[model samples]
Target: MSIRKVVFPVAGLGTRFLPATKVIPKEMLPVVDKPLMQYAVEEALAAGITDFIFITARGKGVIEDHFDKAYELETELARRGKDDMLERVTDFMPEGTTSIFIRQQEALGLGHAVLCARAAVGNEPFAVVLPDDLIAGNGRNVMQQMVDVYDRQQGSVVAVERVPKDQTDRYGIVETGELQERVAPLTSIVEKPKPAAAPSNLAVVGRYILTPRIFELLQNTRTGAGNEIQLTDAISALLAEESIYSYEFDGTRYDCGNKLGYLQATLNYGIRHAEVGEAFREYLDGWNNSRDS
Candidate 1:
């Protein structure tokens, strides 16, 4: 009831990233100093989520290893008197947090990947975080903001942002009744509507706070675009049964699923990194001066 669990749908093959993603999972791709998945996990952790359900695939074993304790590495770092590096490695995963990985045998759609976590999710409301959508929040993270909305709404809440109307075809667009400032009650949701046909510019992002009932809806959802079951279709059905709201979360989201967005995230995070922030900024300024001259 307090939203203690979260589902991470990370099983997709990163074909967009081509050769780099051929071996490494896109979720494992680093932004600056940390992997994309680590940021998602840290965000959820900030929201007090203790149980994590990772829907994974065959090549995603490295992700599991990423979260697991690096005993040998830690020991070596300690032996070498690298306390700072050892702390960083040992602190990757905090104690008392549970991580469960479920294999998505086939590369289905996002909806299907979520359905795979039904057993692990059981009957509680859970959050679904897509690591590819690296959201940098202002003060409060996106998932935390949605959980607060769920507390008041007592239904489902999806994270939405005002995307360019022309890019409506790229994301699931939501139709809303009226705006309660940042939050709005959804009237309907259409997956990947064309620019001309899109209901509104507000498009659903990666963060979701869904009830367990969604698993049932996902089970009956037919494959839509890309010949795979669409989570938007399931959420559209749930709209008929209960109230679902969309929150225009206060955050900057990087669509790390594509090459441009990934590079942008790396540059943005790199410039602000604690260790290299000032130096990176200086390097950028020097590069710009050199290029201009």
Candidate 2:
């Protein structure tokens, strides 16, 4: 079945971003001109995902408002002959597509957050795009690449990228078999395993094309790492029954959940913004020259 729906788990407390996130959802942080979540949504749109299921928590209202049509503002813009602005505001949702938001009442682990999306996903396979993993792709979105891989493999596909061996403990590291070029059949998945015991440095990124069978596995999954239901634990069990593959997606991922990553993403996206890139490059060059002097 074609992957039509995508679940975005956005209920985390975002403690890493503290004060600013106290009022604004971390996903609402601006990347360049748009919020971080907007980039993820656009990427999903490019991947042919028709339904957007947001598993959210409190203080995420900005996310809902950002994607919804601003009727009042649009009316004013139209009255003022601002067609360009109106087009930008009204062009968000595609025709005949669904954007539903489900509230995740408690702060649970990623596994529990995904479980909240099971009803919307039904029996069909769907994709999961973590907004925190702001992937900057040259052309194809990371999720699009995974979906294409899934079409051929007709199995679950997760996005993987090589990380430093020492950083394997920070992610769900994948153990894979012989590769088919960029895609490899996953042999196993170890979550936050010690660097010494890690199977490989091929770490699973935040994108996944998962089957509905995972809902049952997630339901039975127990609390893990940081006392929350880790999605890695459930995927580990699902691997025992179904075949899952890892696609070494070509993209640069920014972990917006971390302070350093967030700052870096701001700079990266700012430097790439069409309206600002040239001026920003000049500014950066001048600043670096001044620092040396």
Each candidate's lDDT (Cα)?
0.94, 0.91
Residue 51's lDDT in candidate 1: 95
lDDT for position 165 in model 2: 86
Off by over 4 Å in 2: none
**Clash pairs detected, candidate 1:** none
Candidate 2 Cα deviation (angstroms), residue 182: 1.0
Every model: Cα RMSD to truth: 0.9, 1.2
Superposition-based RMSD of candidate 1 using all C-alpha atoms, in angstroms? 0.9
| lDDT for each residue of candidate 1 in 198-267, tens digit (9 for 90 to 100) | 9899999999999999999999998999999999999999999999999999989999999999999999
The list of candidate 1 runs beyond 4 A from truth reads: none
Which candidate gets the maximum lDDT versus the true structure? 1
TM-score of each: 0.98, 0.97
Model 2: per-residue Cα lDDT at residue 88: 74
